[model samples]
Target: MDKKDRFTEVVKTNQGLIFKVATLYTNNLQDKEDLYQEIVFQLWKSFDSFNEQSKLSTWMYRVAMNTAIYNLKSGKKQVNTIPIDLETERFAEVLDKTEEEKIKVLYEKIQMLNLLEKGIILLYLEGKNHQEIASIIGITISNVGTKISRIKDKLKSQIKTT
Candidate 1:
């Protein structure tokens, strides 16, 4: 396939992954949609540089995370507190209602995290390994482990106190 075709295929297969990253950074539908579009634009612009050394999903995660981080830092999109009842139909299909509710609660707590911790936990939730998280976030593997442990403990404490 040509570059355009390849890009389309990659995006089609990984759209959920992109949306997950977007949702982690955004609180409302509008901002989620905007972040998704920005991520796609960045992916398309950077497609030529993707050398297949890493999985496409991994690269997409890196790009999406970076874009979201930049957007957060620039104040282009302030993170809002996501309500538990907020509809997330597009990305909620994988889970049944109960699981979805649990996820919503988890996300609510996740929103309390700092930017780096948010990225780390999101990647961990996505099942990315320590090495992959480290590479994507530009940190060492040991640091990834350390951060994930701390973040998990923090989340656990938050859940207990709530």
Candidate 2:
């Protein structure tokens, strides 16, 4: 396939990854939509140069994560919260009440984290292994583990206080 076609296909397959990253970093619907487009544009800008050393999804995640982080830095956080979207509603539909509450609490705690902590924890929460998290965050594999342990501790403390 051509580069554009291949890029389109890859993006189509990984839209959820972008959406999640955007949602995680942005505080409002407009910022989320803006971040999503910025990520896709960055992916396309760097598309042809992406070598296959890592998994495609991993590369996509790295790009999306970086773009989201950059967006968070540039944009102001809105005080008003967004209503849960349809995808979240669909996800909550299957989970029992407890799991839903737990996830909601975790997400709220995550908002208190710094940018790097947020990135590492989000990747860890998404089931990324240490090496993948390291790759995405450009940190040492061991550092990823340490950061996650610390982030968990921080979340635990936040949970207790709230």
Instruction: Return the top candidate by lDDT.
Output: 1
Per-model TM-score on C-alpha atoms = 0.85, 0.81
| Candidate 1 deviant stretches above 4 angstroms | 73-87, 90-95
- Highest TM-score model number: 1
Q: How accurate is candidate 1 locally (lDDT)?
A: 0.83
Q: Encode model 2's per-residue lDDT on 1-162: one tens digit a residue.
A: 888898899998888888888888877767876788788889999987788886897888888988886776767655444343434566668999999898777777888999899988888888989988888889999998899889889878986887
State each candidate's clash count.
0, 0
Q: What are the lDDT figures for the candidates, one per model?
A: 0.83, 0.82
Off by over 4 Å in 2: 76-103
Q: Tell me how far the alpha carbon of residue 60 in candidate 2 is from the true structure, in angstroms, after superposition.
A: 1.0
